[model samples]
Target: MDTLAIVILNYNGQSFLAKFLPTVLANAEGYPVYVADSASTDGSVAFVRTHFSAVRLIELPRNEGYAGGYNMALEHIQTHYGGATYYVLPNSDIEVTPGWLDPVMKLLDANPQIAACQPKILSYAERELFEHAGAAGGYVDWLGYVFCRGRVFATFESDQGQYNDNQEIFWATGACLFIRAELFHRVGGFDASFFAHMEEIDLCWRLKRLGYEIWACGQSTVYHVGGGTLHKSNPHKTYLNYRNSLFMLYKNWPADGWLWGKFLLRLILDGVSSLLFLKVGQWRDVLAIIRAHFSFYGRLPHLHRQRKALLKQQKAEVPLYPHSIVWDYFIKGKKTFEAIVETSEK
Candidate 1:
């Protein structure tokens, strides 16, 4: 029988895993389940050992962040697990619904050209609503901002046959993505430079460049408890999001001019945004933006080197028009960071 390896990256997500593991194991029977824990001090490793000894656990020496943790686990899945045809990367905070795995695996089996397939992810807390991070499928804008089909920003719509149609997307959410192990290895897995945020987008972009398609399997579904591990407003999260976004733009743009132009636009927009946040007495958010930019500057040289190497190997045609890949499903308005924070907290 063909084998599958389900890789879950954990970091003090014991509460989430306590509920998620059983459901995943029940649905993902006959597959090798692996948990790559990032040295959680909250008894995450001990809990797994006590309750789910069947799960192959690899405790890291330190917190290597999400991308690094997954990469470490991917290495084990490939080398040790041997016949793992599919590698499913699910966040520790998600619950897999019944019959979800079959559709995802079936789609991959049917379409050999598809490098990855993701299930429809609904919010775990609000069953009807779509999650903020990656609702249905992922898309990228001209300025390198990534969004999804069913939801955008704070405007999440209920998933009621809106994205029922199966289609190819620019990328899939890292929350619950399944890919052919060979294709994943061919793309060198998630870019470790990302550390955490937007790594999936970078991986999917590389897969597309290699002449492979990323599909959204509408039939399969999973529930995502958004921001279960990292709070949405964390400054570290902000830094990674900003830095990795810039890295993605630099690496994927057809030319250097495009990358520079986007960078300038982002800087101007972020500056204005920071000023507005400061005006509204949201000094913390203002500082977050400032710190994000400063962090990006500190890592610019390393990012540039990586971008140069990636661009040198690219032979695929970059889409000239943004609308070709970006579908704007969210409304636009000038909103302060404070407003977003307040709304999310509610």
Candidate 2:
């Protein structure tokens, strides 16, 4: 019997905890549940302790964002519980379904090559539509853009059994990631510097680069209420997504003559996006992009060192979408993921 521990990292989300934690507890009857609070002053820790006493609690000294908070919490789990075979890191806002863990667990157990996997994530609000964070499974395009099988840019596909087949994916949703315990530590876990967004891709890409597979088990499903912490419109979330995307590409993409060109292209795209925001008078978003660029520039030295460290590890040629997602979506008017994939195949 494989030992699995489900851990949810919370920060000032007492209400989310109040609503969703019960569903998680009800569904996860056999496995132990834990609530890792990131020093939230909103009494999240107290609420968990008061209502859901059986759910183990870890009180982090300070809020260090998702990457750092999870690292600390998982480390504690490894130390305290003797080492669970699997770790399921679900967001505070996720509503996991009954039997959700079985398929993903079976997939991981059946394939030693698979390091991480996620369930088919639908939207909590719509229930039938796929969510934005991760619709089905994620893939990295030629331009380092991450899109899901059920979503493309802002266009989300309805739950019409389109992505029902279990398949290999480029990345798993961090909203509810299932990872092997040993492999998580072997790769040094999530990069704490990522702070929040795109950290899952950074971790998954490392696993992918190291020749380990990430998977999506279609048999299981979860509903995600995204932007629980930072709304999509928040400039800070924009900064993290844009900047960490650059960071991920910088650290993981093979260092070659063409890598610089790709970076340049991405920069131009970022600038174009800022102008679009400017046209709409989203001055804050424009500043966020500028700030993201400058922040990346400031971290170049650090990223260079990190890149060299990654090179020291054994690597394999990771699979990529091999097409320009931006061109296919914006120029060719391919809105759905199925259309993009069909055109790529042709």
Candidate 3:
């Protein structure tokens, strides 16, 4: 039997952990589980130690965001569990359905070119609804926005038979990404600069450059409670989502007109969005967007150097069609964000 190491990054999620740990442990047969705690104040460390004695715990001194926390935990896995053939980065708020891992591993075993695979993620809270974060698989737009199958922004509908067929995708969500340990190391793992959002996309883009395929297995499924740790309405998450997207574009896109063209388009859209939010008095979101732009600008030089180095290492350019991934997100005549704010105020 091939060894597997499950790396779960925790941050003040004791409440979820109470339920998450048991479900994960039950599904994690023939695998070792590692809980990487990011200095949770809510006795999360103690809870895990008491309940999951067999699980390895790596408690950080302080919160190092998502990327840092995972990287820290990965170092231990690489050293101690070097024999692990598969490495799973599962979020702490997910419940693995029966036979989820077997399908994913089987696909990876059969397809030597496939570097990573993700399970069909369903919504935990909404039950019948597909999870907004990463419904089945993830894809990106030319404008650098990320969307998933069975969902696009607030347009999540019933699964139906939309994504029943298993196929290759541009990227897989980090929430439940499974990768071959060797390929993960080959592409150098998730970019730490992202800190959180879109890091998986960045990693997958790099893996594609190295001649690896990312797939979504329809047979494997998991339930994810959307916004379990960070509420969707939270300004902090909005900021990270926006900022990290820009960082991703800079790092992954070819260092030429393509990169600048996309970056400029994002700038225009974000600027308009900020103004629109201000007009409607969504002050927190507006401020969050501003902060994200300024923070990214501050680190432009370092980001440029990193991009140059990464581009040089690329062995091949994977062609992705824009229309295949570009989604409207505003389905069924849904009200736009501005309209929602206006109507709410009225």
Candidate 4:
């Protein structure tokens, strides 16, 4: 079995596969590459089969979304390639550079403590800027608000080589995440219920709780065309992001007094976000936020069960940004990551 396997999850991304597959295959020298198709009707599987015949294709029966699709695909990988050390789960809409996997894979190989990591992700269209999904690395605020070293909320920082150092982070962007194969299953893979957005953060949070490090390896890099599957402007993406963020906090945060206070504060922040959406006349987005909260409330029982199961297995402390990222980015006008870090230091 190959020590590493690069698996791209695809839905209806025929164009992306046709365009980016060559770069992926070229950079994936000495590693097995697989495409896990989520039963796309757009002839995505057939195209891959016809053109990239060497690339292994696993066709699922239906579209289970990213979370479920990866879980299912990884399970297949585990069963078949039990000796494989690492799995790279990249989005279909990514373009990799030469030697892109070396730095991150080498880091993981040397450090068993690190369960997962991602390379520096830049924007494909705008090469100078960090990508929204994962700029340098991902981190979360005290209230479960996720942002990256080069991205804070909607504001993205340009690539100035500020985050070049490989460092431990709260989460690795799923856009091009490289994870230790065995540990991925051990921590109980991504929450299938989430189905999509914020699932990577939840998985990383779980890994962190289990005393495993997640990191961003800046020595290697890739470009991502964000919003390939679900565009940022779509209210459905907003809804899933909002609902899943709450679900993540509920399932992972400690059951101590700290939980309720943070949850309430996050709710208030979410309300503020709703108001901002209203100001922009994004009425559907506002309704999406409201619906997200209701969905969170409805799933409390399931989330509680998950929390109980997780807590029973691990009691490690997961790191979160000491300050509120929302306040820092919006109120304090800290746009770039360097600015935020500098402000936090003061």
Candidate 5:
């Protein structure tokens, strides 16, 4: 019957658990913490049960990845601990700061329209740099290209207090997300089909369509080891990210001329990315993007059905950037987020 509950999802991340659990447990005052284990074979369950006995555990039958695991865990939390007003989904590899939850919780309580928010995420390895996952807050371009306020493609801005103000954002990072329990279920939770990347953005986009806002609680901060489960360098990670981004676009975007135009533009961008990888002799990465495109095309009928279902849930038109991030970053040489914003305004 607490006001907040922290649920950390684990899948063969015993090392991460061992390293980061103490900080989470230490900072988790006035709330309960649970480790939702998705059939971890690395003795993560045993480690938690033995060392962190105070933390509750939810054991899943198989590794359902991030979207599925969280969906399952949140369902359990809502059903069993219905009294909890907020659910904090922090990655297992995050080193949370003390009072991290207060700012986000206060923001949610103060604003009834905000369905979710995230703390400022810094890099665990290089603490001065904004983490790739969710630096300050998340945003997307017209072409479905996702970026953060402090991060662009392969470029991260240093934490220089520029993004210190709490502000409304397109999406909150799933890394240290604090969401309203009721609103989360009402949005039908995350699309489990995502299975990994871009799922949080999809969920936030859905919430936005329903006229709910998302924000960033910059006062509350956390350091995340960017790629705990799937390393950024992995070709499979590239495949999932590329494919899921397309899936998200298909489901959320209006299926008119706009959708096709954006999809074509994204395809061109993806081709350029593939050629860049080819130039670097990253054959696997190039192939991953190609495979991702094929998979997306193959799944269009199913995704179209999902798109129709999502349209039925729309209460308001979601906002999106009219400009292309690729043109801004690559063609115009706008490196930092501040520069991008400035140029857009001009």
Candidate 6:
């Protein structure tokens, strides 16, 4: 039997769990539902234990963010139940649809080459609009800028059945990612050092490097509250985004240009982007970008070792947009997915 486990990693998101967990259990009738709580002191563990008798709650000793939380939780699961064939990693804030698992699992089962996939993520507050986290699928530019198929920067497209077709993609959103358990473990799981943010893209990049495809199961859909752990505009999230992005690029090596040179350009562009924050006196954000670069530098030695080890098994060129997403999105005002889709072919 092909056992699939739905593991939701949560960190002090009791409200989200209370709001969405019932729907998850209702929709996921047969499959086992697990809530891996990341040391949430807000009585999340007690709440789950008291209210949700059906959920298999695994309370972590400490908060290790998303990467470490899942790594630890999945390991615990593997030991306890001999593990499932597939794992569905969902953020606590997502409200899953009925039969959400079928299309994604079917796609994965039909294609052994596909290691991971995600359902279409519509905004929980604005149901008609695609969420910014993983709008359709996700893509990274040659400069390591990660964007989604139906989202460019902050622009979230409305779900008009435009991206209903399933297709291969560079990365799946961790907000509700479905991945083969074997492949997930085989890839060493996520880089826990990332803490959170961009870790999914990093994992997908490694799988793609091994000749595995990541996909968007547009047939399945989920509503995400988006940014349960960290709000989109939070400075810490900014730090993680910039720093983990650098971490991802270093670990997965860009398709062109020297890594440092590209990073230098990224630094310049990041500085330029900070002008927006500077205009509004959000110095913490400007400082967050600066801090991200320093963190990247501090981790270089360890990252270099990781790069060498990871590349030892590399088999394929990592897929990335050949153009700079910054230039296209900002300079040229090509704010839509359609405007940039043609660039992939050119």
lDDT tens digits, residue span 135-188, model 1 = 888877576766676765566778887677678888899999888888787668
lDDT of 5 by residue, 200-301 (tens): 999999999889999998898999997899999999999999999999999998545687877888888889889999999999999999999999999999
Please give the ranking of all candidate structures by lDDT, highest first, separated by commas.
2, 5, 6, 4, 3, 1
lDDT against true structure, model 6: 0.90
Judged by whole-model lDDT over C-alpha atoms, candidate 1 comes out at 0.78
Candidate 3 — worst ten consecutive residues by lDDT sum?
Answer: 332-341
What is the C-alpha lDDT profile of model 4 across 22-70, one tens digit per residue? Answer: 9999889868899999989999988999999879889888888999999
The residue ranges of model 6 lying beyond 4 angstroms of the native Cα positions read 255-257
Question: Per-prediction TM-score, please?
Answer: 0.89, 0.98, 0.90, 0.97, 0.98, 0.97
| Candidate 4, superposed: residue stretches over 4 Å from native | 81-83
Backbone clashes in model 5:
0
Which pairs of residues clash in candidate 6, taking residues 3 or more apart in a chain or in different chains? none
Q: Which 10 consecutive residues of model 2 have the lowest summed lDDT?
A: 311-320
**RMSD, each candidate, Å?**
5.5, 1.1, 5.6, 1.2, 1.1, 1.3
Q: Give residue 99's lDDT in candidate 5 (0 to 100).
A: 86
Per-residue CA lDDT of model 2 for 1-346, tens digit only, reads 2389999999999999999999999999599999999999998988888899889999999989999999999998888777689999999999999999999888998999999999999999999999998789999997899899898999988999878778999999999999999999988999999999999999999998899999998999999999999999999999999999999999988766688999999999999999999999999999999999999999999999999999888478876798999999999999998899899999
| Superposition TM-score, candidate 4 onto the true structure | 0.97
Q: Give per-residue CA lDDT, model 3, range 21-120, as digits (tens).
A: 8888888875888898999999999999998998888887777777777777777678765637888988999888878888888888899999888988
